[model samples]
Target: MSEHNTHIEEHRDDEASKLGMWLFIFTELLLFGGLFLVYSIFRLQYPANFHESSLELSVTIGVINTIALLFSSMTIAFAVTAVQKKNNKLALRMIGITLLMALVFLVNKYFEWGHKFEHGLYPGSDLMQLLERGHHLYFSLYFFMTGLHALHIIVGMILLIIVYFKVKNGSIHHEKYVFMENGALYWHLVDLIWIFLFPLLYLIS
Candidate 1:
């Protein structure tokens, strides 16, 4: 009877954990949704300038980052499945791949940002100060939105690392992987946001 009660309590806790994660994700969505609405309003207000500014972005780097995040999403999903299947080694390998892809994405972003910095295209540079109103607004939104997404990427990576170590130590395994599941959900959210960002910030040109 005690063992059965413990099982019931564990299930409840897992359910509660999942619900909490969903709530957090919902809040994140609301935040980004607001940002997206603002972006759309400005994009409509300065269509030509938005297009011109977006042309300055390297589509090659944007596509590469997109692919990296997509691949990472796949690997993380695989990791979750591996854990559920009780294949700890496979789970670890998948998580490693996911982390590597995330690193690739961030590294590419670093170089891309550096390139913009070299050209004095960032938010506070004299070049930006001299730009037209539309151009200035475009760059501002570009930096703010992508920078915010990059922050989320770092947070997602931290969550994945925690999940990795937990899985390694057997704290998150087949029978109890709520943490891993939640981490993957967060990672996917990161990727999804980038999906929206890529076209809006890069391909619109």
Candidate 2:
């Protein structure tokens, strides 16, 4: 009877943890949804400027980053599966691959941003100050939105790193992996946001 009760309690705890994560995910969606709405309005208001500004971005780099995130999403999902299968070695390998993908994305972004800064195209540069209103607003939103997304990437990376260590130490094993699941969920959110961002900021032009 005691063993059964413990099992039930553990199951309830898992459900509660999932529910909490969903609630938090809902709030994040709301935040990003509002930003998306604002972007839509501005894009409609200054279609030509948005197009022109977007043309300044490198579709190649954008596409590369997109692919990296997509692969990372797959690897993280695999990590969760590996844990469930009691394959700790495979689980660790998958997490390592996910982290590597994230690193690739960040390194690409760094070079892209550095190129923009070198040309004085970033926000607050004197060149930006002289741009037309529409152009100015477009770049402002571009920097703000993408910068915000990048911060989330960094946070997601941190969370995955924690999950990695936990898995390595056997805390997140086959029988108990709510933390890994939650980390993957957050990473998925990060990837999903970029999916919307890629087309809106890069391909729309």
Question: lDDT by residue for model 1 over 1-205, one digit each (tens)?
Answer: 5655654443348888999999999999999899999999988998999988888888999999999999999999999999989999999999999999999988998999998899988889999999998899988988998999999999999999999999999999899999899999999999999999999999976
Listed in order, each prediction's TM-score against the native is 0.94, 0.93
lDDT of every predicted structure (CA atoms): 0.92, 0.92
- Taking the tens digit of each residue's C-alpha lDDT, what string does model 2 give over 1-205? 5655654443448888988998999998888899999989988998999899999999999999999999999999999999999998999999999999999999999999999899988989999999988899888888888888889899999999999999999999988999999999999999999999999999987
How far off is residue 30 in model 2, in Å? Answer: 1.3
- Please give the lDDT score for candidate 2: 0.92
